[model samples]
Target: MTGTLKLPHEGTPGSSAEGLDARLVVERGAFRLDVTLTAAPGDVVALLGPNGAGKTTALRALAGLVPLTGGHLRLDGAELDRMSPESRPVGVVFQDYLLFPHLSALDNVAFGPRCHGVPKSQARAQAAVWLDRMGLTEHSSAKPRRLSGGQAQRVALARALATRPRLLLLDEPLAALDARTRLDVRAQLRHHLADFEAVALLVTHDPLDAMVLADHLVVVEDGRVVQEGTPSDIARHPRTDYIAHLVGLNLYRGEAEGHSVRLDAGPGITTTEDLTGPVFVAFPPGAVTLHRDRPTGSSARNVWRCEVAGLETHGDQIRADLAGELPLAADLTTVAAAELDLRPGAPVWATVKAAQTHAYPA
Candidate 1:
């Protein structure tokens, strides 16, 4: 099958600013991936998905590491579809932090400049500047073997940035770091990415990374883009179960008439949206209140009788998985749960206020 993609408007940085534009179609084995992406100068776009979602495949296509079976690739209005990897004005940071073990941190970063024909002195100077910006000046002489995971990641990012490419690509950037180091490095990475004056694309399965680091998000599933929007937009209105769980929201699709919506499972809910026809109703699990018995004088208009099938603790909140006429998930504080004596195999009434139920056209 063939498809057409309309390029989106992009902003320029300085008078000579450049951006990235790609419409790629790549096929391998039984799967074919197609994506059209455009990022303005200094825009950070995250490609989010689970395994086998083609996030990495799309990144590689843009970097010239994977040949596109069809479509076009352009950077700064220059055609790059036929260019080799070295000829493309792009930089990549792989997941493994592929630093040359024989070289020191400074030398590893300088390698890119050296390959581009810069003098050794100039390359090392530029490398030093990038390392210092990453707060790794003290580790300049340390080799990859001697550097910790976080240190190595910083060095990798510095190396990628040293080349001053018009487009940057990163794959699972923070996946290798420990929890403590991940937080620190993520913040530092965001700062440096912000300072960059070109387009940057990151591929990751981590929701927090995408939300915190990127201005826009593209969610890919099964080798296709399922959703694309701002981070807050995707979090607020997820289109699939995978994304609903990712953003910690309970989502339901139903037919709506005025303010009332009937679920496919045989229950009606009151919504605040003045929408009609098919619509989606969504609310966070925390919006649900569970009681052992039927509630009295409760202002909440939507209530359902549910049976607890499982329970689990998610950080400070308790997530109770319920199954009944309408299978749903609810989150509550440990204190509230204790007061309600909630447990597996217990029957309970679930209530949600109409104001809290968000409705949008499906």
Candidate 2:
């Protein structure tokens, strides 16, 4: 059980040690997918998208569970497109934590080693080591049915890691947990995943999970990769409406002249940047200030007259959905909203300073 498994074929001396290089294409009845992806060793790349965006399909292709209609898959420089799921040096933890109900936690983790030809005793020994690492030694004899959701998840993780895979695929690792358990499990998962030297790919629609757990993000839409960058980069300047909504920002595409940008929706916004040509204007809801009426002596360059279409509490703040000359979203304190007597159909003026508005080339 402690012996080294055969390493996957290395491409070149300069290539990354434990990453994935793949150009995956899968076609079903009416849907088509084409995505080229790469991840560096120890990089946690999250495939983020809404349902039917092909995130799961891509991950399955990487795991060799789904056959590729075309394109290549290489893990740690070894060709995997032709390998069977069992032959590939990959590990996967499904969302449901598919542990055998009849098996003890110790036996569950030992299954992989036993399948790989190790003796039962040796396999259990290795499994015990992994369980210990996961802080599950005391529960080694517990059956899967008797384990808590988080405990079962850890057992699943330990089972996968015990195999020492070159690539790890996780599908919604924290989705099955309750709100209270999610917070604890999320932190533990982060620590374990960080220690993994192999490439890890996670598929999740939850932005909080993606932002908190992954170092980089790959955003897919309509079966195509629309964007890929670090979490902070995507958060700072989102190019798509889906991404904007994911990162909680209001985005507008427009043409820029000097320090001002003219939106296609018939409004011009001033910005600190002095750029010309096609641009994107983005501002968080918190940057917007709502007023009952246009305030005099206001130096703010960008002001719009709008009517409150709706209001809702978002955490400690109030989100005002407005409709009028230009539809926009603004966030204010609940106290402020109450003081302003903000309500549906209330006339209001929204103001945003040029410095607070960010403009980037579209």
Per-residue accuracy of model 2 over 59-144 as CA lDDT, tens digit each = 99998888999989987767899899998888899999899999999999999989899999999999998888888899999999
Q: Which consecutive 10 residues in model 2 have the weakest lDDT in total?
A: 1-10
TM-score of each prediction: 0.93, 0.94
- CA displacement after TM-score superposition, residue 312 of candidate 1 (Å): 0.9
Q: Superposing all C-alpha atoms, what RMSD in Å does each candidate have to the true structure?
A: 6.0, 2.9
lDDT of 2: 0.89
Error of 1 at 337 (Å): 2.7
In model 1, state the lDDT of residue 204: 99
Candidate-wise lDDT, in order:
0.88, 0.89
Q: lDDT (0-100) at residue 297 of candidate 2?
A: 79
TM-score between model 1 and native: 0.93
lDDT of 1 by residue, 1-362 (tens): 01111123344435343577788899998999988898888799999999999999999999998999988888888889888899887889999989999999999999999999999999999888888877888999999999999889989988987887888899999998889999988997887777776788999999999999999999999988899999999998898888998998888989999999998766888998888898888998889999899999899998899999998998898999988867788998999889878889999999999999899888
Clashing pairs in 1: none
